[model samples]
Target: MPLWSLWWAWMAGALLLAILEVVAPAQIFLGFAAGAAGTGLLLLFGLPGLAGSLPATILVFAVLSLIAWLITRRIAGVREGQVKLFNHDVNDN
Candidate 1:
């Protein structure tokens, strides 16, 4: 069986991504971690289509990652005064 067919591998990947998110805390890897977890769950449940096709599984993962990222962004929007607008370059003298 291809490595993708193994659900545990995906879960392991999710765990790694979660760890990265913790280390970075930039709200980036968490979405990917979520996607990996979702894919793992689908594989664990014996999703026939995902189990047989690498491309399809990857596509699903990408879609899930995108959706999760969008949701995360929406939930944790930019904080007030987060943006710093500078009219003059610091090096300009």
Candidate 2:
């Protein structure tokens, strides 16, 4: 394994998720992609502690994902009445 393989994995995951976001346009996968890419960047930049601990890296990814999700939601809120539409009975169609 390369010394920065883990980081590379994160970056690769980010790339895949980014592609997924493009294919789906759901505003979900992009957030995860951002988080993973951000984590990879942190690793690439030589952050301490995270480079040495798997658990720490996972935790960081989770935290970053959450933050990214919230930011994405804030910046691009659901379309008006989108939720109520989803809640409608499918059988009614």
Among the numbered candidates, top TM-score falls to 1
lDDT of 1 by residue, 1-93 (tens): 988888999999999999999999988899999999999999999887889999999998999988999899989968778997999999999
| Cα-based RMSD of candidate 2 | 3.6
Cα RMSDs, all models: 2.7, 3.6
lDDT of 2 by residue, 1-93 (tens): 444436888899999999999999988898899989999989988788888887888888888988998899988977666775366776896
Overall local distance difference test of candidate 1: 0.92
TM-score of each: 0.84, 0.77
Error at 67, model 2, angstroms: 0.7
Per model, state how many residue pairs clash.
Answer: 0, 0
TM-score of 1: 0.84
